[model samples]
Target: MSLSLIFELSIWITSVCGVLVALWLTWRAGKQRDLSALAGFAVMMALWCFGHLALFHGYQSLGMVLLLANPLMPTFFLHFALLFVNEGRACRPWLTAMTRHIPWIYITSIGVTLYSIWVNAGATIRLMDDRPFFVFTESGALNLGYTVLIGVLAHAVLLLGWRHHSGNKRRSILAMFGVGAWGLLLATSFVFPSFGIDVFPYPMLLLPSYLLLLVYGVVRYQILAVNRFANRALLALVMMLLVLCVIAVLGVFSGRVGLEALTNVPIWQLWLYSLVVLLMAALVYPTVRRITERLVFPGAVLNEQVLDTWSRQLNLADSWTQLVSDGEALLRRQLGQTVTIKLPNDTAPSGLHLCIEQGDIGWSAHVEKTDDLSPGMRLNLEVFGSLFASSCAALERSLALAEAERKRLDEQHLVELGSLSASMAHELRNPLNIISMAAYNAPEETRKHIKDQLARADRLVGDMLVYSGKLSLQYQRVPIKSLVSSVLTTLSTEQVSIDIQVEDTLQIDADSHRLQQVFINLIDNGLAYVRNLERGAMCVEAYLDSGRFVCRIHNNGPQLDDVLTQDELFRPFVSKRRGGNGLGLAIVKRIVDAHGGTIVHRSDCGWPVTFEVTLPPDNTEGDV
Candidate 1:
């Protein structure tokens, strides 16, 4: 009930909190050597605080027992500092040398404790200005020397480690340094009462601050990889205790303002104060957590703005593939971990995975890091996965409807073209045949010109039928070089210089006549564009690559119009060349499609225009 009693009880509570912190850190240690050393340090710290408490209560024998054990406190701290710097890396020379001295320090501590016992030396509780303080005898100086030696050595090691480390490790070292310095300063102040300095030793009552700093290191800098749930619970517990400790200290100090006021205050009033503190803590906890998240563990919790942006990007994706790729990239950037998104059919990459399914869509997302994801991150990922699945499902349905409409339109177009082709063949080819027969009876000089006109008209009719009609392939093993050379021999080569790069033994299984048409159309385009030059350049190449037959026709002529879309470039009626129906490439495209091949336009191969035709391996064969 007295002010002194209240202060003593506050110290007792703080000592107990230190023990609890020791247990918590020990539980978190796992198999990590650095963490084990840290747990050991915490244990010694708890014992040191307990030793002071025992001395204050006049338990001389028990206090001496604890005091004898206190010499190992600095040893544990030094070992912790050394192990921390060496974690996940080879030991540095300075740390290695420092580590070599640990056993000697341990030996010296034991010797000092024994000497202290032999001399009957330890601190005695004495009243200093009506407050209990520890006063040490001269023989206790050996203990002080031992403690100071180890404390200085540990701090020096921490300083070096801080300078040598970077990022989270550096920050962790700095936190430990601050805590160590405070502890050392407090330990030094304990010797002041022996010198009659009359210091109140208020630093001893602030022992809980050491535990708070360590918790901050674990939560903020990730000194220990505790999960988000545990972090929150531990933080809440520590904050509540801190608030109560602050309140209790205030209650004791208030007795100075009105000595008789709190002295006669009923015990129930104190209980009422504690209950109100608890209620206030509940109300303040959310705000405290927000501050802690923003300042202490920044970026660990994804904010609404980030989640909203991620969702928006995911919804904007046009296909399931795009959605998965973008989602993984976003998560990788946000979490600083390698992320993978696996569809139901995709093999999952190695790591911890979260499977999410929405509607008929399902995928698993994972990070390469083996550490379990924090609760906030895991929840964010799940939400992201759900949003991605829903968006992908909607996109899939939309695409399916669009594809169906596209196919229907294609079928209608094909029917119209078939009718048009039949009409053109019936209406135009008969007149071309009659013109050819009439040209034979004309005068020799005039008959030559008429024959040329008749031939040109006949070729135009044939191109239209090929463009609109389906191809029927007569498969044969066609030598690629022989086919290309035969097409080139049919065309006049005066205006263009041509290069052929096909191997004589290279062959493919295709319709020989239809395939020849493919080459003639492609080679004629190359010659038409290069006609302005006295000898423009062109090259024809054929080869097998990756189980597919490839032929590339390259020319130094002007490139295809950059403004044309892929579909427009292959349209039957589209032509940019003079005196030509645009049916040459269109017919080529039809024949290539019937043979299960792909054609691509290239501008990246140092050519003005190039068309690459790639046939499916099934429609292709090795050399004959």
Candidate 2:
């Protein structure tokens, strides 16, 4: 090939590559307003490259028509920059006004150039050193105007870059470099020729390189915010290119071996050859796709296995600490690196990190030797991180349910033991009372000690029976005020002040004896914990609330300890006060439950301690 033909071919190839890359970028960028502006910019660049290719091929009219799109390129770029900064919202009024007139400016410049061409006073094209170059035959006003317009747009884009750099320095620098390089090339193409320099449009050949830099910015910084569909489209494009390369290679070999026969071949044979090539591509596509996926995403298989194992382990994990430790160990094994897991209050190490959030709980993981991670490995890590978050949430819920079940079973076992002990105590009560009666004629001190021991044994048996549900209630309409008076009269010797707030007519359907026992246990328990017996006070308030008879028994006792607050207060053998069997509240709870009532302890009812009970009311009406 001649030097000029070789140069023309090189320019054509470069233009074709630039057009392909730009079109791909346009398709990948999708339909967001900012991305649409970017797509427009890419289209203009493709048209500009096509125009130069056409000019090299001696298609002057076609080249001029395509080159008409060139002036719009910088305008599209500026629009893209404005949208990028403002996130596709309306920009400053000045910027909006300036952008609105860019098309008019382009039209006016094109009009001047066309008018000059019509009058045969336009720029002339001449062959110098076997290369065609443009030279203005008259005043170079058109070239100067185009150069000035591009310079102004370039400065505007640079300013935008500077403004955006503060928040995203890497992406801003990359965008600026790409835009500046292209602007420099575009300026040199016209400015050098306008200044009487006879160089060809050598800068135009660098269009493909400029496109590569922009594409790098898009891929590295997600400039256009391309989605997964774009990634699949890019993969398809790569596959198509690979197929084309194969066909090209086959064509070259066939031409070398069958040059004479190929020249003599009929049109039908060419069609047949094309059909065979298409058939081969269709058959090879799936196999090629699988291989490419394996090569490009080598961690996919391992990621699937790791995720499956992670899910199973989380399901089986008995505790949060166990789950986190196992997850960290699994990740370390899969990635072949040290991993640090951080809980909510733990300090996070400096490294590449992923955050896992489960409700209000958050865990962060720092990856050691991050430089060893490939793109595929990083992708796997993201999938694993998301799974870890959801799994941790599931594990927490699972563990909570398990603990609740364990506590329920423990309570059931305690109830069974209480029943056995209560039965034994019942059997011993009669014999103990008989012994005390028999010793009635003995020495006074001995008889008195036996009587005290017998009374204590009887009280213990009563408490155990109530706690174990061994005692049944005989429900009757019991007046609230009278019942309270009776219980207080029995314990009147205790130096504690009692306040009653129930009406005389308020009554409830409960076993009067059991109801008295409930009050006696609660009042006596309160007195036991009171800090000052002389000043210690108790209040018994009753009212009808929400279709139930509500009673609140409050005392000025010490607040319950933290340990006692956590499910220990109403459990047998767990006491907060001295000289107590720990069964008073437990028996009280059982009796209330037997009467189909609810009782709960409250420390926030303007009292140091309070027990509120809600019971079914009797049919007889009573005043509040």
Candidate 3:
């Protein structure tokens, strides 16, 4: 083939490849609005490639038609840039109307060009070495209008790049360079010729190079969200094409440099060369694939590193505060922005927020503006948020388990202390009884003092035995009202009034002696707190609730502290009263628990203080 034909054929092949790449991009554009605009730009470029092919084949009319349509290509590119910069915001009404009219304007311009061609007897058309081209004899109104249109589109693209550069520096820089370089090449190719300048083969050859740059922009800057399989496949195809091109170049070099001796080898040697090439390709494919994957999709590697680092930080964190602090730092580093985490009970900071909740723990991350964040970064943030929530949940569960274990150990210690107190009280009781008998025969005042000391010691011993669970119950049918009345009579101090509100027939199967002790302790506690009040009185009310016998002892004393819950009230050595051993409530709780009952203090029961006890019925058919 002649050199001209060879050059033309190379242009034809490059244009065909460009068209194929354009179609592939269009097919993979999917639901992204900005990507669809990019796809439209690709299609327009493909049309320009087809036009170049037509010019090479000497189809002047078809070439003119395609070339006339090619001016719209940059308009599509500008539209894509605007949409991408705005993150696919819907265009304003006037802008939408302008977009809708762009095709009609292009069509009118093409019609005007064709009319001028026919009217002037195809004076605008010319042939250089049998290849068709367009030349303007003068700067007519149509020509000036088209130039202004291209200028406006180019300026808009530059403005978009300038505005978005700070937020997405790499993509913006690539985009600006691609647009400027392509525009320069296009002006040199077509407009310079209108001024009678010869820039022939460079224009045709450089068009393919410009399209390759565009492909690079798509791959490197990620103008679209291409899936892994499609991205890898495109890379593999490009690698294969490059390998074939290299082989062809080597063959051409050999032929030109008088290396005919190598070509004159036998047919089997050619087969061996072909097999060697294939084997080399098979070996090089994976290496090229890895490099391409790293180059085109660095976000995948970044995501993995982020997750690994976050997991390590979470593991190393000893508390929730540290975990949150580390997570905030990790997010800031990975996302390339400041991040503030607002935990439960923390004051919320002002910024764009992403809230994360795990069980009872909730936190919000105040981050940079939403528009500044890329889709990949947003996805990574979501992943990190989930991981953070999970870690917080695990930490909370671990803390709760530790607290429960501590409570168990404390209860065991209290039990041992109670046992020791009971043993010591038992040994002291024999000496106390002998002193009481000896004091009865002495003077009246000494007898009264000895009796009072002996009674106080006896009460302390009874309390220790009850707390230690050493006292046994003798269950029998007992009337509730009579039991309360007898305990009040025995312990009356005349300082606080006692009110009984139990039905005379209401009966419970419980140890009478132990049951009386529970009432005495509860009443004494109420009297101690209510003695200073103007209407100092204790009310004992008994009723059945939900198939269980319930009793509520209420007093008009100071309310329980809001900070302490009912569960805390039953713990050993915890009391709100002064000069008290703190075992009265604990012993009462043990007696109720031994009888398979639940007791809870209610500060909100319309009284300052109340203790509600619910016991299973005498013949109830279940274990407590």
Error of 3 at 295 (Å): 8.2
Tens-digit lDDT string for candidate 1 (245-265): 765765677678776576566
Clashing pairs in 1: none
Clashing pairs counted in every model = 0, 0, 0
- Cα error, residue 462 of model 1, in Å, equals 28
Write the residue-wise lDDT of candidate 3 on 263-362 in tens digits. 5655455545765786688799878977886666444335466678888888777787788778778877776666676566667667745454434345
Query: Best lDDT goes to which candidate?
Result: 1
Please identify model 3 stretches exceeding 4 Å from their true place. 1-308, 318-322, 336-372, 389-397, 400-404, 434-443, 470-477, 493-495, 509-513, 529-535, 557-568, 576-578, 594-597, 603-606, 616-624
Order of candidate numbers by lDDT, starting with the best: 1, 3, 2
Higher-scoring candidate on TM-score, 2 or 3:
3
The lDDT values for all models are 0.74, 0.67, 0.69
- Return the TM-score for each candidate structure: 0.46, 0.43, 0.46
TM-score of 3: 0.46
| Model 2 deviation from the true structure expressed as Cα RMSD, one decimal place | 21.3
Q: What is the C-alpha RMSD of each candidate to the true structure, in Å?
A: 20.9, 21.3, 22.7
